[model samples]
Target: MRNAPLGIFDSGVGGLTVVRAVQQLLPSEDIVYLGDTARVPYGSKSPETIRQFAHEDVRFLLDRGVKTVVVACNTATAHALPSLQERYQVPIIGVIEPGVEAVLADPQAQRVGIIATRGTVRSHAYQHALALRRTGLILHATPAPLLVPLVEEDWLDHPSTHAALHTYLDPMLDRGIDTLLLACTHYPLLVPVLSKFLPDGVRLVDSATTCAEHVKQELTKLDLLAEEEKAGKLEIHLTDLSDQFEDLSRRFLARSPGRIMRVSL
Candidate 1:
């Protein structure tokens, strides 16, 4: 079981951020990544639909014999994590709780701002988790649905992307948030652009990185950590494929995603 690959799925290439983090942290563990590009932008889907899609995604990964599953999509994690955990016997992790834990780690994160997809914002997963963990936390969350398309389009430095970011974050800035939790995996790619505009003291908590850390911790606790010394392998699967998706995958992974296969999930 230690040699089994880690399973991760997302609505699209955005989840590659989680894959990249996992690869960096746990170099010896193999990974199987499924990008549901055919149903990209799950943020607009209904809660019931999101849960159904999540179940299918997990089933696909489990079929591939993964040791664990990571719900790298923020919207799916928000809407379907509990159900996924209940339905799957393997250890299933999601991006939301790890992000909330990251926020609570900082004693100074009194007023925090969250920017995620519409579905994730609607789910209130982050807010609810933080409320359960600690008290007196002032939270502001907004849906930045535009940023996902912008990032997927590779418009990290585009003026329109900056304008959209300002439009989403300006209100949070006005509220004097000390920490900004990037609830979506796709948002980490915008860190450079975000740093250029955010104030000096505002901290950024990236869910992808935190989720990877949490995965490592959980695997260790479960005695499932791979004991190999060599670098791990990665497998890329997508429900749909396109030239744009190929390019976006490369950008998200910071390297060539070799031999991407199209699968019907």
Candidate 2:
């Protein structure tokens, strides 16, 4: 199974952050990525709907022969992971758990701020995950649904973006949150702009990056890390062609994002 390509999926181009991390960590492994651009922003949908969509996504990837699946979108992680796990045989990794694990492990972590979509924050997934165990950690969650559209527009460095980000974070920063979680995959692209508004002491955590690290370890343990000779080939499947799925993804992934095969639900 080491030669089997890993499957990664996101609501849109945001998951490219996870793909970028995967590329850096496991350069030899081929990946099959799917961006559900037609149904972008799973944050606002119901759990049943999200779960159904996620199942279709998993089925799509499984049809292509993946050894593992990476859930790169926070919204789907909150609402869809459980059902996906029940239906899929391969190992499954989601963005939330690994991110929370990182925050809990930080020695200096006192208060952690999470910036995510409205649905993610409302689900209280992170808070519930951290609350199950006593870790003496304070959680500050902010829902910034607008950022998703802004990131899609490639407006990460826009002055307006800085204002919105500052509005969401300044309160948490003032409350002494030393670590900030980029709860949404797309948020990482705005890290540079976020840093300008945030205090120097604050650190931005990429859940996708941490998730990739955990995924690599899991794949290695399972003897599924594809060799170098088997790489340089990738498959991209999309639910639809709207939202400039190809163009925006290219900017975020830093590649042309070749072979975006389209599929209907």
Candidate 3:
């Protein structure tokens, strides 16, 4: 089981952030990443639909022989994690809990700002998770659904992106949040642009990085860490393949994903 690949799935290309983190930290552990590009945005979907999609994703990964599954999509994590875990024998991890741990780690974060997709905000997953660990938390949640398409378009630093950021984040900034949580995996791609807009004292908390840390911890605790002396391989599966997604792969992995397989999920 130690040598079996770690499975990761997201609603779309955004989950690559989690992939990058896992690869960086656990170089010897193989990975299988599936991006449901055909149904890119799960944020607007109903909970039942999201849960169904997530179940299919888990089945696809499990069929490929993964020992663990990481639900990298915040929306799916919010609504589908419990069902996925209940039905599957493999251990499952979600993005929300790891992100909540990150926020609580910072003592200076009295007022924390959360920016994610419409569904994630509507589900109140982050808010609920944080409430369990902390008391009297001042939280501001905002939905920046536009950012996903912008990042997919590779408009990481466009003037239009700045305008959108201003509109989505201005209220959170006004709340004097010392820490801002990038709740969506795709938002990490805009960190350079997003950081520029943040006040000097406010720190950006990237859930992907923290989630990856949690992955490492979990694997280590279960004695599932790969023992291979050399770097592990990465296999990417997309529901639909395209030049744009191929192009974005470079941005996500710092190189080509190397032989991507287009599969319908």
Candidate 4:
């Protein structure tokens, strides 16, 4: 079971952030990634709707023989992670909690800001986590709904993208947040752009490095870390392969991901 590939899924290409981290951390382990590009941006959906989509995504990954699953989408993680973890016998992880834990561990944090999609912000995942563990800390949550769409459009460095980002973040700055958590996996890509606007005292926290370490620790504790050095492969599947899809994915992933095979639930 340890040698079996781990599965990672998100609503769109953003999940690649997590995959990049995992590859760096566990070079020997195999990974299978699924991006629901056809139904991208599951952020605005009702919890029930997001839960249904997450269930099917998990079933699809399990069908592909993954030993574990990681939900890399913040909206899906906020709404679907607990149910998916209970439904699947294999170990399951999602990005939100680990990220919350990471930021709370920061001794410098007094007022932490979480920037995520509408659903994640509405779900209050960060607020609740800090409230439970470190009630004294203040949680300032903001919804930057444009980041994911801009990322999917491959406009991370575009002039229009910067304008959009500025518009979104200006309000966050007014909220007096000290530390920022890029709560969405997609937001990490914009760190360079964000650095320009954020004050030096405010630190940006993203899930990749910490999440990768946590996954390794969990797998080790479960005795599920792969021992084989087999040439682990990457297989990317999307629900719909738009012309824009491959082009954007190529730009986002920095290479043609073999083939973005189309599949369905």
Best by TM-score: 1
Candidate 1 lDDT by residue in tens digits, 206-265 = 999999999999999999999888789999999999999999999999999988999998
Who is ahead in TM-score, 2 or 4? Answer: 2
lDDT of 4 at 118: 86
Give the winner by lDDT: 1
Cα lDDT tens digits for candidate 2, 1-265 = 8888889999877888899888888888889999898897798899888888888888888888999999999989999898788877899899999998877776787788988999899989988897675468788999987788888888888887878877898889889998898898888788777777777888778787898899988988997887656454777788887548778878788888886888775
lDDT score, candidate 3, position 88: 88
Note the clash tally of each candidate.
0, 0, 0, 0
- Please give the range of 10 consecutive residues that has the lowest summed lDDT in model 4: 248-257
Q: Pairs clashing in candidate 1?
A: none
- Model 4 misplacement above 4 A: none
Order of quality (TM-score): 1, 3, 2, 4
**lDDT (tens digit, per residue) of candidate 4 on 1-265:** 9989999999888888888888778888888999998887798789999999999999999998999998988889888988998888999998877887888778778888778888889998778877888868877787888777788776878988888777766666777778888888887778788888798788888876667777888899999989887666788899988888777667656666677789987
TM-score of each: 0.98, 0.95, 0.98, 0.93
Rank order (by lDDT, best first)? 1, 3, 2, 4
- Give the local distance difference test score of model 2: 0.85
